[model samples]
Target: MNGFTRTVMRTVLQAIPTILGIIVISFLLLYLMPGDAVDAIAGMSGSASQETMDALRDTYGLNDSFIVQFFRYLGGVLTLNFGTSISYSAPVLDVIMERLPSTMILMLTAFVIALTVGIMVGWAMAVFAGKWPDRLLTSTSLLLYSAPNFWVGLMIIVIFSARLQWFPSGGAETIGAALTGWGWFLDRLKHLVLPSCALAAFFVAIYARLTRAAMLEVLRQDYIRTAAAKGLHPMLIQFRHGLRNALIPVTTVAGMHLGNMLGGAVVVETVFNWPGIGRLTMSAIAARDTQVLLGILLLTSVVVIIVNVIIDWLTTLLDPRIRS
Candidate 1:
């Protein structure tokens, strides 16, 4: 009925083909890999009879023709009836959902910290361009961007966790802590500190650099000079005017990355043993659980579409010129 509704509908409709493309490509790639879930199961079991493997494939419909399997899987995806995961012997959807909350929490904490701190630091860099502060921040961001995330995570754990004993070494929570209420939330927060930092580090570098460039470019514009000529407070002029407009590029990159957020967390999740979707995805990959892998891919594409829609709405809200 309204413009935003219309935009959302149009976007969803347009995304249908994209989602289909992702599904087709991922399915073909995974299914075409050297082995299927049957082989993984057999290998893990030490060995299996030829007939046993055949029957297992048949049970999972893995012996179907490629076209048949593709359509069958696609149909289930469309209907939200994602097939069972071989590794877990459970519905793929249910299994992913079980681990989704932890990933979501980790992602939310990392994203918020990255965007907020990145923008603030970027603003500072722009304000102090060519100075010691700018050089320092730039060097720090470059360090974060260059370092391997898993390595960063390991170092953080060694110092803060293993040595200092400030937080648990790794995990979503204390095993059998039986915490609840604020205590429960606090414990979760403590566990989150290391992983979130590791996950956010790369993104923070990216956003900070992007924001710095965009802000610097924006501040050079005529309007910024005009605002300065009006004798506005330096901080207000730098942040309120320069930073807001500069957010376009930062927001664009952030939205583009929301889709891959879960995937990127795999390294951090693995390092921290966080029991999230990323860890589950790693297990699925190791086991070659095509059904679970496909389910995760499909969900990721859906998340991309949904996040883009939200980002579009927010962008238009932030910059009213886009609404027209």
Candidate 2:
């Protein structure tokens, strides 16, 4: 087949073993935890009898050997069955799918904000390296990078949300607003603003720093000097030549962060009370719902793999050297 299709196919093939390993590890880790789904169900019910608890354990095959349980779960997973969630009393896959959209929107918004703003800020920082502007922005990035995620969300809620009343404090929508068309879009965008910013804060700092460094390095290359000697406009040289190549490294780093971005969502979702996989994950953890938890982890791994595959494809398209 063609090169692009082959590359993507190769990536998918390589990811199969990795996904399997993740599945096995995730299952074992959850299995080793103090309690199982049965315990969570029992505790939530307040007074489940020992007999009932034993029956649950038996029904779920919890009493089986670790090897037996693993194979059973693996068999189900291979067939696209994620079992059932003890906490929600629903199929794990179904529950995850219901919440996936909210999480995807939040993360995508955060990623866009982080990447776009960061590249611009970093370009500026590189252009004025060692100057006051660079110093000020550098300090700002450090502060933002150092801030705890939850605290960032809270402060934003306190200031922009609680004090200024500029945006909705939490949730994915205005609830009973019954908004439609552009009206619905704007309302959802408002609710998305604060949490996205909070989630993006640290990543913005990271991308900004990486881009700044990559820009500096790219600007020093012989091609950049050649372009400048050709009397190209300063902005054209800075962006078209410099930032274009500089983005190669930034893209690489961003690909690696795809998985982590999902993890970061847990805090942001919890803070804003946003309905998403991250929030569902927290709920699953609290209830020790291994089935739902496994489902989320598997879905997250799949998403990360898919995104990284796309990133890898983009990297080749961006850098001719890699393509060759």
Highest lDDT among the candidates is held by which one? 2
Query: Candidate 1 has what TM-score?
Result: 0.97
For model 2, state the Cα shift of residue 162 in Å.
0.7
CA lDDT for candidate 2: 0.91
Task: Count clashes in each candidate, considering only residues at least 3 apart in sequence or on different chains.
Answer: 0, 0
How high is each candidate's TM-score?
0.97, 0.98
Whole-model Cα lDDT of every candidate shown, in order: 0.89, 0.91
Candidate 1 CA-lDDT value: 0.89
Q: Model 2, range 173-243, lDDT digits (tens) per residue?
A: 98788989999999999999999999999999999999999999999999989998999999999989999
- Pull out the clashing pairs in model 2: none
Model 2 spans > 4 angstroms off: none
